[model samples]
Target: MNLFEDLRNKIGKSVAETGQASKRMIELSKLNYKRKEKKREADRIAEEIGWIAFLQWEKEQDIRVNKDLKSGLERLQYIQNEIKLLDVDIEKVKSDKLLYSDNFYPTSNSPSSEPSALLIYLCPYCAHQVGEEDRQCGNCQKRYY
Candidate 1:
């Protein structure tokens, strides 16, 4: 009878120890789950910050690009204006040369061969030379005497 009582006592102690170990394991598992949740939350916040920083960078790039484009267009406009002025100057030089050459070589029908005090009419629309008896312009169809 004494041996059976000692065996029962040992069995009760072993059951109690097993229950305590099970409780400890449950607590440890809960702690691990909480840590994982905290880490996930931190990662989410980091992602949001990164997105905001990217948007700001994009805005700055847009401003710089716009400024560059505006400057380029202004430079192009200035160059075009200079080209137009140069073309006008070239036309004036050519007209002056033509006048000088014509004066050097007088035509057979020039005013020098005509009688003195000869009457001539000029067309007002196209500046065409006309005879004194003419009443209409032949080049631009304008009426002029």
Candidate 2:
């Protein structure tokens, strides 16, 4: 019967969606762990820079020309850049979890054949998910208007 078939299809779709969500969660968790590790490395590099500065000061040496300090600073900058890149990558992964097919396509029972466009807005500061009618970001508490 059509009713039984529809119910079976719905259950199958739900199971598939749950699986996809679990995969996405695992991907996000991995990315977040990487980002946290990068932050920790940044902190370590910062501590190294501080120690370098302290030693240079104790020796009454010119801090600007210190090769060790310079290298540490460079490494810190590189790590910061890496963290920024990871942030972008995390946002990309989050966006991929969106149900684009459901947003764009009409269901089988629908009379209209044309696909509808769904506009998704994100917070500028934190990339938090926001609705089109939202005036403020819920995550960052930043005002859009």
TM-score of each: 0.39, 0.64
The local distance difference test score of each candidate is 0.52, 0.76
Write down the lDDT that model 2 would get: 0.76
Backbone N/Cα/C clashes per model: 0, 0
Sum up the clashes in candidate 1. Answer: 0
Name the Cα RMSD for model 1: 52.1
Residue pairs with backbone atoms closer than 3 Å in model 2 (clashes): none
lDDT of 2 at 48: 97
lDDT digits (tens) for residues 39-70 of candidate 2: 99999999999998988887885666478888
**Location of the lowest summed lDDT over 10 successive residues in candidate 1:** 111-120
Which residues of candidate 2, in runs, are more than 4 Å off? 97-145
